[model samples]
Target: MRDVAQPAVAAPAYVVGSGRNATLSPGEIGSFLKFDPDGSGGLKPRVDVPTAQAVVDKDLSSTEAEPKDATFSFAGDAATVVPAVTGRTIDYQKTFAGLLDALGKQGDPTPPTTFTPPPVPPGGTRADPPPATGRAVNAVYTTTPPKVTTEALQAIGPATVIGEFQTTGFAADSGQNIKRVADQVNGATVKPGDTFSLNDFTGPREAAQGYVEAGIIEDGVPDRGVGGGISQFSTTLYNATYFAGLDEVEHKEHSYYISRYPAGREATVFDGVIDLKFRNDGTTPILIRTLWTPSSIKVQILGQKRYDVTSQTGNRTNPVPAGVKSLAGNPKCKPSKGVDGFTITDTRVLKDVKTGQTTSEPRTVRYNPEPQITC
Candidate 1:
């Protein structure tokens, strides 16, 4: 019994990653076994679950990997699919059970053969019995599947440019902030019936996240603050969502209108305080892609086309004249020209391609007058 168990004691058990050969050894198979006296006064080998689990934790824990979902990469007008990766984790309970079963067989004696060997011909030598080989338990592994697979992404069909918008004419610092926010928003995929929030996705936009101090509106006045130009990204994304015929969950317009953006169709976002969000109402997933230049930024929404969308803006009305403020001695004062504020309405028209049905949705926005700064 000892001799039979000796070979099994030194047998190596393996834990392996997916699609790879077994390279990690969870020590010897007999490390989980202990000799104890049976009730009949005979020694018996038993498996220690804790010892087996310890060996797995030490050797197999490090082999775990996180799964990655498939995504799209765009170049110019073309998009390519990036394959998903499978994740691996050790199954401690299952592995311990396998070790215990293998140990039981290792301690058992081989049964006698019942069949007789064939008679050898005259002057022919008989063949010797084959050498016995010990078997070891292989550690079990569990696989975690990625949420988005390549086939699943491909089944959504080829992507079409459903909505696109661009905004330009920004200073260097402001352009940097715009680009930073754009980088965070690019390549985002919104599944069907799922809502995407700009603030939630980008988190806090502070200096640590590469945002710089630029121009912004504070209490209806121009001021310098971190992540100032992020509103341009929010406005761009908002317009794209508008053209995509998606559901606008939440959005807030700027306090004052900037000539660079449409009067009543722009959006602003402040971390935690304000957010820009939209829901994917279509049946397929939508992918957001961003492109930026030195003084300009563009956002594009790509997915299956479901609507033909158009927009109309009403004439600005209820104009309010600007007021003047003198800040000659203030070091933080930045001189700027005053602009009149007004109210305007913007309408989005959507025509369903499948049914040839049309729907019109209108939104009204009001802006505060910009105060003249005298320095």
Candidate 2:
């Protein structure tokens, strides 16, 4: 019989997405098929399920995204809801099954007729392989919804101003630091029974994070450091937490009293050392809203009004006189008049709105006299 010729067959290929976005292909996902000779003389296609699945997982990883919950954005005294984002993930099993089914429908190739071999010329090569061929099957995907949807947040309740406090009279540099920290803290939400930490939320206070050198108390003396004026924010937040009837998890009083802050109620923070933390003790989530101006900063807590809170500051006691300090030759020295140190107590009286019950929490703070400095 005369020699017979066999037509070239192409491997199957799969693709996801469409148009310009269609960079994903079957070869990228995994090598799913291998050809084996049938006893009758034709080639049989077999799919490696495990290998294909592994490749699918590795290839689709970049396509996966985490869902984001909805939250509120506060401007002035009004609040607006931010919509949640839906996430997407590929359905590996469905995609693989669909691809396999598509390939099966194309059917196996017919066996080539028997033929006599042809001799190749010396130093010559056989013809180049045929170009790759395959069918492009679309991938299946599933969407993930956010846990806290905008509708759910709105159904909770209206954001009532439960606590609010404002502080003023900071210099320009200190004011910048204060505003930077305030921006980071603005519109934070604390879920019920969850504690919010200033350090944990804002991370490190470095220049890279947008904090600048400003006035700060270093070792009971006036100095300048990055994020110096943020303590004013801490003091303001502490007062807001106190008036909101939230549980104070951790807070520390300033080493020396600043005239602008409430004597016994003020708080100070140092990164990695001192921190301002508070727990949302109520049933509903609380939103922290911060606002700042050129000379002032304000913090407000918005949530259910569970308690009517008030403060009573007692008289200062245990007076300690400030001593004089001379830093005549030091370029970094800052001069100031000394102030007497004393101990004082701030009592928070909480009255339950529903039960009409009342409770008192007393917090005492001691200040170390600020020494008079001479540069």
Candidate 3:
């Protein structure tokens, strides 16, 4: 026995690298060996089949796993991307084959062995790391990003109707004014946290502004004014924006109730003296759309949906009861329509379905019955 030489033995296991050098223990690697298709090891003096496979599997799993992808979220005014994670897993059969090759070549002083790492999966985007200040950022992975993104919003494409109102009764000249005013308000864009004004956008109503003489309600009587019929446009816009959950900066009800309007929710604009104003107290921008037919005027608002608004109108009170009066002999005198006088209030409630939040706004209007008169 003095001259006999002992056979060489392979190392029990090998170390593998992962994200930031995370190590897999031999015990964990040992569990995966039975799944190897090829018998563990071929040489009698080398590491066993299970041990060799365990080493390979652990290394492959560590370096080849794929990461989870990122996603977007909107909370109030801030747009954010939730961060993603990285994952890895190796090619089982090939890596295991490499391990078999290493086991066959093992010797008394077994040196560490390595196989070429598997190719990385295509570079996928995960949410970027939180900013140094730990604030969320709006970053995305694809060319077609989320619709609510700032870049996507910058172009502001055709809007989706969020709220709308329409009326089908109009006189020709009044209809012209309605069309002209609606044209002025159409395509108007309101930035986040900004205010929109009917008078400002429509400019002064004069002959030069294309305003024609139309019948308008003035001091409880129907009078002719250059921008007379524009009140219908104002009323339409008021209801649209009102339902869209905007804040009314200034609005006034008509002195006399017009049967066509939605009770107390209407507004009247008289160039500089009276104007319809509302604030876009929202996290995103909004668009105004106006449409006018031969006998109809419609107004609509467009923006990202946030709040759900519903309106309720109280029953009419103080009905003067009479309905129209006829007056003669005064050609220049304005006519009065004797509709019943009444008082009513409208309540608009806004509910934030996402956050379970709510707010309410109310408006009360009193209309004096304008005795119908003939010129």
Candidate 4:
């Protein structure tokens, strides 16, 4: 009977300190012991340790927890965040040890003992003053997290359009293909040290991909093919990228001169065979914007402006005679207006706007005459 007694016990419960919602109070939090002496000068305890552990395990199982990170969601111009929660749990092993030790000094006014408190994990956060009406905002966090966090992404600013180019005049189907290709290039982002390919970005221009039959120049002859007019879009994008100070990776001039395109400065593309590409040479990201209308196509390159681009054109140098093609009794041969053959020279001159230093890149282009057809 002397060994059987109610002793002071210890169990830790966590209470919300500040900026938190709920609070907690633990149970009796101590131990009941019945100590007995063994025959071989050793003491054995008849204590219900399992019952003590069960009470804590059930109480702190799911209800008490750690902190959670705040989550953000965006809809149109509005942004919302789910707030974070801080939680607590019990340290079972430490509390059990403390309870056993408390039994050794049990008294009417039980001795003070401490139990180990479970750590509180981090939880979600709240933005100050909420977000402005019709303005997008991100959730704030308590600690410094990775860049993928909402706070980090919201810091990025919009791209600035540094250079732009436009071209007009197209057949209806051809214009649609141009619009489709323009849609592919629009809203594209290129990271620094990365290359952007016209063919790779727009992909194959098959009929399945919404391309229509349009006039195309192939093997020095004019023909109709699917995705034919996208080259005009490519040329527009090429000039825009070039004037934006991006480094040209690959480009091909038209085999024959088209009066609509700028002499010695236009580019053309063939699916997989020919491509237009440029590299983002600056240290920042580049964004492409396209505006396709029934009458004209526009491409704009956006990024931090670094240089002033200026180009020079030399006088038309060489001229070749136009060939004659007789189409007697052939109704299928449409009347082809004669195109004069010529040669031209052009150069891209980049000037550092800050230092007024300049550099030049020259190009020579040759155009073959389109045969004069008689029907």
- TM per candidate comes to 0.66, 0.65, 0.55, 0.58
Q: How many angstroms is residue 32 displaced in model 3 relative to the true structure, after the best TM-score fit?
A: 93
Per-residue lDDT for 1-375 in model 1, tens only?
654356445444443322222321324455666778888988876667776666556645655567767777768656667777666666666655545444434332433222222564422222322322233344455778776676556655777678999988888999999989898877678889999999999999999999999987664446899998898889999999899889989999988788989888999999999999999998988888889999889898988889999998999899998898787877767788888889999999999989999999999998988888888
Q: Return the lDDT, model 4, position 329.
A: 65
Error of 1 at 176 (Å): 3.2
For model 3, residues 1-375, the per-residue Cα lDDT tens digits are: 111111112223333333222222335333443322346653222234455445444433434434543322336423344333344334334333444333233242332323333444333322321211111111111222222233333433333556778887889998888888887766576888788888887778899988888886554445777877878888888989988888889988888777788888888777689988999887777767677899888787776766789998999987776565554555556664467788898999999868979888878788876666666
Note the residue pairs that clash in candidate 4.
Answer: 9-30, 67-121, 67-122, 67-123, 68-122, 68-123, 68-124, 69-124, 70-124, 84-124
Task: Flag regions of model 1 displaced more than 4 Å.
Answer: 1-69, 73-80, 86-152, 219-222
Model 1 quality (TM-score): 0.66
Ranking by TM-score: 1, 2, 4, 3
Judged by whole-model lDDT over C-alpha atoms, candidate 3 comes out at 0.61
Best lDDT among the predictions, by candidate number: 1
Candidate 2 vs. true structure, TM-score:
0.65
Model 2, stretches more than 4 Å misplaced?
1-82, 85-152
Ranked by lDDT from best down, the candidates are 1, 2, 4, 3
Q: How much lDDT does candidate 4 score?
A: 0.64
